[model samples]
Target: MSGNEISEVAKGFTYLEGPRWHDGRLWFVDFYTCTVNAVNDDGSIEEIAVVDQQPSGLGWLPDGRMLIVSMKDRKILRRETDGSLVEHADISAHCSGHANDMVVAENGQAYVGEFGFDLMGGADHEFANVILVNTDGTSQVVASGLSFPNGMVITPGGKTLIINELFGNKITAFDIEADGTLGNKRDFANFGEIGDEPNVAKRIEAATIVPDGLALDAEGAVWIANTVNQKATRIVEGGKVLEEVNTAPDGIFAVALGGEDGKTLFLCAAPDWDEGARSKAREGRMLATTVDVPHAGRP
Candidate 1:
C-alpha cells in the first residue's frame, strides 16, 4: 500500500512542532508564536494556550488533562478541563538545555527528551537522558546517552518506546517495563552516519540522515522526518528507508497520523530552522497526506 497525493491543510504558522490529532482536529504548537492551536478540517484555527517560555512537546494524561512541555523554563504543565494550566513537574536541573519532545504511555507515564546542549546558541553537542514523569507529578531519569532525542512514540500495546535521535541519525527503542520504566535500550533503526562535527550548526549540516519526529504504523514501521535530507522517509526496524517524501522548500520537523481512517499523515514543516529567521516570519505550515498504514501508537 502507498499514500496518495500530498496537500497543504494549513499555513502561515511560526515553526510548528509536536503535532497531535485529537477529537477531529489537528493540534500543534508554534515555536515562535509560543502558542498552541487546533485546526479544523476547513482550516479554521482555535487557539489553545500561550506558553510564555515557549511550548514544545504535548501529551494527554490518563484523566484527559493535556500535558504541555514548557521549554525554556524546563517544566511540564497540565491543562485542566476548565482551560486552566497547572504545574505538572519541574525538570530544570535534569536537562542540559531546553526540553524538546515527549510521549505519554497508557499508564500516564510521560517520557521526555531535551536538546542536551545549546542547540540554538551554537554550543557543543551533549548527550542527554530521557526523563520519566509519573502520574503523581514526580520525575526521574529512566534512560541516558541519547544524542539529542527529539520526538518519541509508544507502541499501542504499551510495551515498547521508540525515539528519534536528531544528531545520531538513528531511531532508538526501549522496552517498557511493567513498572512504567524503560529498559533494553538498543538501536531500532540506524542510518549511515551521524552528525559528528564539533558545533551544532556544522553537525546538522554534516549528517547523512537526521531523524527528528516520527509516526508509527499498524505494521510497526515508522515514518521519519529526515531533517538534513529535507524529506520524510518510512523505515522499518532495521533502518531500511522504504519510502521518501520530499518536503522541499520547507523541511519537515514533526509528524502525526490521523484522519477518518488514520492514514492521514500530518507534516509540520518550515523552510528555515534558525531561531532568528523562523521567529520573525510565519513560514511554517501543517501539511496532510495519506499513507499505507493506519496509526497504531500513542501520541
Candidate 2:
C-alpha cells in the first residue's frame, strides 16, 4: 500500500502501545498515562481501565476476560466482570526486565518479555528475555539474552512465536511445542542499515530504536511499528519488506488491524517522547490509519 492511502484516525496520546482488536473496537495501552483505552470506529475514545502502574501488553483469556500487563508493578492483572482489576500473577519472580508486550494463546498461556537491562533507569541491567506464564500463575523463562524483547505474536497454527528485539533491529522466531515451550530460536529479520556508522551509540540514541508493538496481517505477514523510522513496516514470514506506512512527525509505538472489515489500522502514536507525555495529559486521543490487509489470527 502507498503511504497516502493511510490516514490518521486520531491524535494526542502519551506513549501509546499494545493495540488489540476486540469486541468491535480497538483497545490499547497509554503507557505514560497509565490507562487502557478503547477507540471506536466513529473516532470516539473511552477509558476502560485505569492502571496506576505502567500498562503495556493486552490480551484475552480463554473465557473472554481481559488480561493486562502492569509494567511498573511487574504483575499481570485480569479485568473482572464488576469492572475491577485483580492480580492474576506476580511475574516479578521470573522477569529479568520490565514487562513489555505480550501475546496470549487460545489456551490462555501468556508470553511476556522484559528489557533485561535498565532502559528507563532501573539497576543491575542483565540480559533481556521472554517468559512463559501459565493461566494459573506458574512461570518459566523461555528465551534469554535478547537485546530488548518488545512486540510478540503467536502464529494461528500455534506452531511458532515471533518476537521483536527493538534495539537489536531484528525479529526473532521460536518454534512453539505442544507443551508451550519455545525452541529453535533464529533471527526472522535484521533491519540494520546498509552502511556502518562509527558512532553507533549516538545513532541509536537519536533513533527510536524500535519501541514496543507489532501485529500480524491476515496473510500471516507481520506489521511492525518501527519507532525509530516513524513508520509501520509490513514483512512476510521470510522477512521481505512488502510496504511501509509513515506517520506524521513519526513516533509510533504500536499498531493493530481493526474496524468493520479489519482493514483499518489503528495506531497509538505520538509526535515525540516529551511532547507525547504532554499531549496524553491534556488529551487522550491516539492516531489511526486505514490498511489493505485484515488482521491475522484470532480477533
Best by TM-score: 1
Worst 10 residues of 2 by lDDT: 193-202
lDDT: which candidate is best? 1
The stretch of ten residues in a row with the least summed lDDT in candidate 1 is 192-201
lDDT of 1: 0.86
For model 2, the stretches where C-alpha displacement exceeds 4 angstroms are 122-126, 192-211, 274-285
TM-scores of all candidate predictions against the true structure: 0.96, 0.88
Clashing pairs in 1: none
How many backbone overlaps does candidate 1 show?
0
lDDT of each: 0.86, 0.76
lDDT string, candidate 2, 1-299, tens digits: 54556555555666677888888877887766788888766778889998888888999998888999999778889999888999988889777667878899889999998866565552443457788989897888888877678889887888889888776657888999888989999877766632232233453564434635778788888888777577777888666888877875666678787777988777666665453344446443456677778887743
- Residue 247 displacement in candidate 2 (angstroms): 1.4
User: lDDT tens digits, residues 1-299, model 1?
Assistant: 23447798888888999998877778999998999999876779989999989999999987888999999999999999999988999987788899889998877889999888898887888888899998988888888888899889999889999999888868899999998888899889876555445566666666667888889999999988777577788889997878878877678889889887898988888886789999999899988887878998888
